[model samples]
Target: MRSAIWVGAILATLAIASMFLLDPSLWFAPERNTLIVQTFVAAVVAAQLTLVTAMPLAMIISSLRNRTKTPLPTYIVTVCECGAVFKSKPMFCSRCGRRLQEPQTKQAV
Candidate 1:
C-alpha cells in the first residue's frame, strides 16, 4: 500500500511537470485551470484503472494455481512435490513451469 501510494505520487508529479512544460504560458494565464485540472484527472483515473486491472489478475492467478495443485504454489509453500511419494527441494527451480531436476516432472518439461 505504501509503495502504491509512492508510485501514484511519483506518476502524478511527473504528469504535472510534463503538463506544465507542454504549456508554459498556462502558468500565467487565467484559463490555465483547465490544463492543471485535466492533468490531475487523467493521472488519477489512469492509476486507479491500473490498480483495478492488476488486483483481479493476481487473485485469479492464485485461485487458478490453488485449484490446479500443480506444486507451483507448493514450491512457494516450501514443499517441493515433483513426485507423488516424496517432496524434495527443487534443484534449478524457475516457477514458470520448468522443472530442472534429475528425473523430469510430467507437469512441464
Candidate 2:
C-alpha cells in the first residue's frame, strides 16, 4: 500500500516534469499558458498531498503491525524454597516466612 502511494506520487511528479520537457512551447503559448500552469500546479499539489497523507498512514500501519506481533504471558507460577507453590508472586513465602526470590529463567543451550 505504501509502495503504491509512493509510485503514484512519483508518477504525478514525472507527469509535471514531462509537460515541460516534452513541450517547451506550452509555457510560451499565450492561450494555453494558463491551462498548462494550472495542470502543473495541480500535479505538484497532488504529489505533495499524497506524501503528506502517506507518512502518517504508514506510521500508523507500522505501529499496529508491531503491536500485534508481541506475545504476552497469560500466567506465571512461582515456587518457594520451602516447597510452597504460588500462582501469583509474593514478597514472602507462606510456609517458611522467608523472603521469596524471583525465579530464574533457564536459557536453552
Model 1, range 19-72, lDDT digits (tens) per residue? 778878768998777766776677767777788888999999999888977445
Relative to the true structure, candidate 2 reaches a TM of: 0.40
Model 2, 1-109: lDDT tens digits are 5565566556656776787789888777776656655765776666677778889999999998998884655766777877787777788888889987675322222
Which one wins on TM-score?
A: 1
| Collision pairs in model 1 | none
Off by over 4 Å in 2: 1-30, 70-109
Please state every model's RMSD to the true fold in angstroms: 9.4, 9.8
lDDT by candidate, in order shown: 0.63, 0.71
Ten contiguous residues with the weakest lDDT in model 1: 76-85
